[model samples]
Target: MVKQANKPTVWFNADEADILEAFSSAVTSTQLIQLIGPSSQLVIIDEAQQIPDIGKKLKLIYDNRPDIQVIATGSSAFDLQSQTAEPLTGRKKTFQLYPISFGETVKDTSRLEAKRLLDSRLIYGLYPEVLNNPGQEKEILIEIAQSYLYKDVLQLDSIRKPSHIEKLLKALAFQVGSEVSYHELAQTIGNIDTATVEKYLDLLEKAFVIFKLPAFNRNLRNEIKKGKKYYFYDNGIRNVLINNFTFPEMRQDKGALWENFLISERLKFNAYQSRFVNTYFWRTHDKAEIDYLEETDGILYAYEFKWKDQKVRFPASFLQSYPEHQTAVVTRQNFEGFLGA
Candidate 1:
């Protein structure tokens, strides 16, 4: 729709200093308001996060333009969120754009083309550019993580030792689909405090690098435990960071990696479809556990992910108590249905 805009559009590449000077100077917003010509009612700030005091300036622009609109776009959410919450408080809607989901990439699983799509997803992990060019995906995501995620972190927080942050993220990449211990991370990363590790994790999550899935509970005894499991936003980045892209099809943990990717993608699917969801990996002290448990609107979907063609059976406890929740095995054949959704 933006490409189809009929009027002439001008993009202003205002830097960090430009925004600071504009905010702390003798000239008020009234002077800046005069410069906005008749055709330029809608001011689109590209990379608005770079500009400090942007929240205040945007509120000023918004109040002045009763007829016009402001569109702010950036790779990270920090810029718009920090400022808008205080000054532009009742205004602004938040939306996120994720990598092309597997459903979007596949039209029908029976088609021969879908196999190729699956292979690409395995190697490239669904970032849009990787979908277009499957070969250079590893390099592209590394560049995004380093150049974009890393650069944005520095601007938001003051960390005297940035090296520890990289190690913390790389540590997270290896521990996907498992509970993360911030204390252990602090101990390993040497000299960095525990709070710093957690702060960096929150920042990484905000930048779309990682997602932590919380434990589930049905108001039962000893449920909803502490230590949430973490998953990287992309499988390719996870594999590359841990130096474990060693032909998973031939590796021992192929089953675990595939299961993690499938569960995470399904969660993303539920969210994008506007369905409210509760998720978990169910386990008991005795070691019997389901790979993924998902509940929505009082209905449940219990899933077990496996690579082999073993016989499936239900747990006596779940069948007796939680029979209302649907149960299924997500194996090679039936897995397509979930991804093709």
Candidate 2:
């Protein structure tokens, strides 16, 4: 979009001291115009959440300079949304950029090539840097996981103990593809309360580090309603958190990694295609479970992700209760269609 925009486009990265100073001092639309130059037809502010009164400033620009287009990008969503929500309510369009998806890789390369790298992707993940740097995925993932992943979460005033957040993240990483309990997480992290666990988890989610999938329950009394499973936005980050980059064949948690990879990629697929769907994992107290569920247009779809070609049978109880549904098992051999590739 930036490349296709008009000439004389001004790009301001808020991370730079001078750029931050200029934006911080631009109190009015006229001042902002002068700072950005009146000749500029498009303006882009990266790390926009770092600038104070950004929403109002953007609003001023929109109201005064109808000729210029302004684009704001920020990594810390909680900060960005809170600052921009009210002032830019009717003035802005928001977009989320996720890690590289299977569909994108297939588009860039071919479905055959993407399929060939499935095992590597499962272990190293689909992060752009990791994907681009084939041999140095472990090192890059380690750097991202350690230095960049928790940058936003650590900056929040609500976060008092940073160590607890790391421990909690490690715990969640280990338990991927399984139900998570805040109380159990609290105990696992030690010295943390369930409320703090929940709060940190919420912050992590806002930071796009992890996402929660709640139990799918409707008419069935035996369905586990309050249960939730948390999956990382990127499998690389999850694997780095646990310090595991072992090949899928050598890893004991290959099943978990496969589930995490498919679900995360599916999430990116659904979002990119603008599919409005509710996602969940279904499990009953009696141990009948479906790996993943998507409800769209009043129709339920159940999916089971497997690393190997294996017989998968959707619990009879689930089939009987939700008769109007579709089911499929996604394996490496047949996952391209499932991921919209």
**Top TM-score hit:** 2
lDDT of 1: 0.68
In model 2, what lDDT does residue 219 have? 82
lDDT of 2: 0.89
For residues 81-185, write the lDDT of model 1, one tens digit per residue. 775678777766666777767676665343457555554565558777766775787788777667765677666666666687778877887676566788988
Ten residues in sequence with the least summed lDDT for candidate 2: 1-10
What is the Cα root-mean-square deviation between model 1 and the actual structure? 3.5
Runs in model 2 deviating more than 4 A are 1-7
TM-score of each: 0.84, 0.96
Which pairs of residues collide in candidate 1? Answer: none
